[model samples]
Target: MPTIVRASVALLALGLVVAPDALALSKRDQAAVEALNQQMQAAEARYRDAMVKIANADPAGNADVDGALEDMEDVMAACAKQKGCSPTTMLTAYKRLLKQNADAAAGEETPDDGADDGASLAADVPEAARAAALLSADGQRFVKMVQYNPAVQAGIRRWLTDMRGPLIDTYENYQYMRQLMWPQFERAGLPEALLFGVMAKESNGKVHATSRAGAAGPLQFMYATGRRFGIGPDATGFDTRYDPRSSAQAAAEYFNERLGQLNQSIELSLAAYNGGEGRAQRVYNSTGGRNFWDESVYNQFPAETRDYVPMVIAAAWLFLHPKEYGLTFPKVDAKPALLRLSRPSSIYELTICMGNGGTRDGYMRALRNLNPRYQAESWLPAGTTLSATTRMVGLYNRWCLQGQRAELASTLVRSNASSAIVRTGPVTPLPAEDAEIEGGGVGAAGAVTTSPSVSKAKSKPAKPTSYTVQRGETLTAIARKFQCDTGDLAKANKLKAPRFAIRPGQKLKLTGCEG
Candidate 1:
């Protein structure tokens, strides 16, 4: 069921509605009240059937759902005016629907990482006019914000099917950063769901995620665009675009600006966000403020944007109504806290010292996202403070402060690969094996030929231009292994100092290094 029906049904079932004095009313009014209650029940039945069909992707379901809701509202309105109607009597019927929602939610399979899965739709009104106002003013306004077209339906289908993992990850990551990000949108009078949609589509809530086109951060603001919104690089050369609070604030301002210019069209504003404001504004002006869905407007934006707008809307729709689709979002214990280093430590060390604590990945990503300025391998000095969740801080105290695991983590992070290899005096070689062997030949006696080249031809092994970092490796270690200056390696990799932080699997240029 849609949000309206579910919330209304829940509030009604929870006994928010009050009963009228039946004995004081005439017998005719009693009969009218009873009839209205029966109508409400029938409408509710139809609403349930329509919800099922809607869940199954039936086109007729939307109309039927709306019709049933209207019918129920009409009955409730009439009963509010009727002398002896008891709103409590509607509870028994709706309680079943409420239980169904709970059961459905419980039945859905949660992913191993975590697939996890709010507002009263209606108010109990003793007065008829108040009841009508409550229904019109409060419960339905949220539902009216966006259009759920076929494009949105397709987007929803994709999210529920192939894109489900991304949706879950976005939800999980957003929860960790919600305190930092959501307040910006909330203060701007924007919907929380819209914020989720944009972040979900843009970066799946990865704080340091950068697009190939040069957009950076959780909200994916380009360098120039971010500067306009007070989210450019700081004096220290750290881009605030990667900061959740800064980026979300910029995003809120951006959407408000676009919405104002685009006649309050969310699709248009979203188009501007993805396709560039210049194109979106130009299309808006040329179309004479036509709806974004109009062919003249829709066709003007690039295909990426055309897909983006709908996907964003669909995500927002699901955000508001997850139970309706049987989708669950995992719960995160993300209570924010500050962690002052008890000793100098890197995030890699901290991650190793602090166990997973039931999370699939350790707290590494969360630490990186929350404390973007520091690289995962960058050593944070004693007394340096970092943003963290309460759970993480607790874990740090329990497992990372001064234990054997903590020492092991520190030792691991400090390890150097170059120290492990030793050089010995050159020795006699054996006969070479088959010449057809790849990567040079081995000897038949298992001792390889020591010649630099075949037939006295002097040649050198080509140096590699790039290298992929391996796990538990560092920039200094890599530089040592390749017999290159650490400073030169960092410069080639464009790594920032003093952190010069690098993650495993990140590619680096091997300029000035022997490979």
Candidate 2:
């Protein structure tokens, strides 16, 4: 008799009353209890798997949460059909056992605001509809502040519906650049889950994202708000708001400041983060220390701010407890590395050649996140190095070298929409034979009429498909030595004739050559 789960944020927000009669079960009924226990255990395992993705802020994690929720719903439906057992009764029974275990550990550890372990927090909280400040044994922390309310339940339901896809996208984006941003929140003694929640909603983890209201960055800082937290533009014209590390640091400090003025309430702090701190402060001061979700205080904020507060909390809640929602986050191989380009290329070209076979999503977003200094289409010189994942480095070596995929990627990136259309201006076609040699240019016959610098070379019978030019060598000499048309060689290298100066290390295509 496994129970169904999926309600996620809603599950935490929804309240229930356990049936008093199920408390006393005879020995003969133990078999039914055992079967139900097994089902609950399986659902929890799936929940744990989904939480890892939320921990990493990966978007695909929601799928598992969705599955778990559906399973839980099924269980609940079945629970209704059970004669003596009910979903509420079973959940309460499980919760009570967990609390007993936590109470036993109370002698050794406190539950909240004092380095609470995950096991203790999970056990102590009623779980059906309660809030707690949770800290893992290893020091990771998250505040489950939006627990057990109709409004919050509505928010969770919304997350399960429309926000599902964006949640995954945001998480995936955040995970790729977590190295650049997570440490900021950690240093500020803030919950990384809060960071992910804010970032997911504000910018979907896109560093360059900006709102119509002039908010920018992963945290969506406004110009004035960013400056207050030591984040703005630098001398080099790079906006610090667009820097994930700087923006996250600023956001952490900003949240801490808001917490101080807003009675240390995460809900109030978040309301201010979305609305204005001044407006939120006024509401708080006028309401005489009223809680953020208090009808009086909640009604004072704008409609958008009211919605924003619960959504942020729900997202943060999901980040901390994706398993409860049945979401399993996908693990990403984000080991860092430096990738040097083998040839002149752009991020656009690299992204195409470096496939997403290793990751759930393509590395394009990851690439852009890690290397924000250049635009995707910016052409980088050969040997230019970029911050990249180990997977990308391996892919670059295998597929982005001088290969078909590499060439195709380059071609794809270079293809211009305007170039695809016919040119409007009159065109000059090549002459059939040698034409007037103007300005020491190459004649149509592949001869230089002036500029003796391109002196003809000694003849040779051998021929090759390509040649690397030596120092002080001229295009005329190489063409003559190969017994090929010089103009064709000039066209191959996109160089003019006459003073066809060739430099050392220059590779020439011997097109139209003859032995």
Candidate 3:
């Protein structure tokens, strides 16, 4: 029999949204509402899955599942206090129960079976089974964690009830990556749950994920690290870290190596992954060679690393038991397979080719999310086969095809617009009738009399004032410097009227200004 954990009830209470019935909802009206609800539920499920996967795959350390549960309960209580909020929302109710459970679990120690399944599972299960098993364990642990942590339980409840849409979407995207990457992770002997943790820390599932430190893949590998693991950096400036399969494989190898060196402890290995190995080792040594939670170990690391472990653990725990935390994870329309691209194309180009569909952006986001080794300023060259989620293959293919056309069109346009300017000399003043024929229309010369000052100024050719365009300067910049309009500058220079493109060190005529 499937064990129905009562903790989920608390989340339900906290997460349910109840709009006031000023207007009765019709069947049709409720249809859209129902659809939205389904979508939110789906998203919640996805997030939960991703979090579980991360925990399952985590080779470094187990997250603070207990703390996350506490937070979830606290969030539930706060939501219960809200006037319009419903306690039935999954998030709200789950948190409430989680807090209650946490309180109940405190100081209650189960007899030690000496099994250490979590440790055994981490070591024995291949990447795939481990992911599945860990997720299951993570869910159970989450129940225990929330039952222990009142503060996190409340936060979880509030997250589910308020802003259900965004939270759901985040979780959905996270799950999409999980389903797509599980197989590769299984083959690599790495925990599948680690992917979610990486995604959460690196991009929060944003595909076009870029870091300030120049990490660009979903796994967030640096150039040197990626290359060391067979995801090469090529002459065409191709960084294989952007390729999901390649990056995943590389990350697996890296993690495996780290584990081998770190006494096969996922916690220490993960600590090394986030905060350098040296620091993790130092923390381990300082803690008298105990696990990650030791006060000495926690204090030895940076604040970010200290916070990072708990966050990863929390996400992993939530993924396993989203319902317990009043969190929903969404299911994405993605396939589980390697996608081969015959031609090389950019994410931007591929997005256009995919008929502007949902999958294109999703894939691009995943690639950007997982492959932190690729730089955005450069484009991935052609003939690169990328491992993509099955759902995104068609869109990626379309993007490749469209990219070729876009590239060709751009090239043609550039060729046609060479630097040579065809000028019809300077404007020559003509008789009124001829001027009317050539220059659209004009008043009779005598009728449009110039002022004495203007006539005198025209009679004497204006002094030639030359200005040079500097680096990082545009026509607008130059115009601003001289306190003149860009249109005026262009006209005086006899280049064009009201439009101009300037290059560095290019000379321009400044009119009606003393410089």
Tell me how many clashing residue pairs each candidate has: 4, 20, 89
Model 2 residue 189 lDDT?
46
Question: TM-scores for all candidates?
Answer: 0.61, 0.57, 0.44
lDDT of 2 by residue, 1-515 (tens): 01121143223212131232455677655566566656766766675566455345556655765675555545544454444555555455335434544554555444343332233334434432232132111123355443447776777777778988888788888887889888776544466778887887788888888889999877899999999899888875567888888888898788867765664577888888988999989999999978987889988888999888778777777777788898776788878899998776677788899877567668888887777666665556677888888888999999999789988996676554543554333334435354555564444345434323324443444657789999866665576566655556777788742235568998888888763
Off by over 4 Å in 1: 1-143, 431-515
Location of the lowest summed lDDT over 10 successive residues in candidate 1: 117-126
State which candidate has the highest TM-score: 1
Query: What is the model-wide C-alpha lDDT for candidate 2?
Result: 0.67
- Candidate number with greatest lDDT: 1
lDDT of each: 0.75, 0.67, 0.50
The clash number for model 3 is 89
Sorted by TM-score (best first), the order is 1, 2, 3
Task: Write down the TM-score for model 1.
Answer: 0.61
Position 327, candidate 3: lDDT: 64
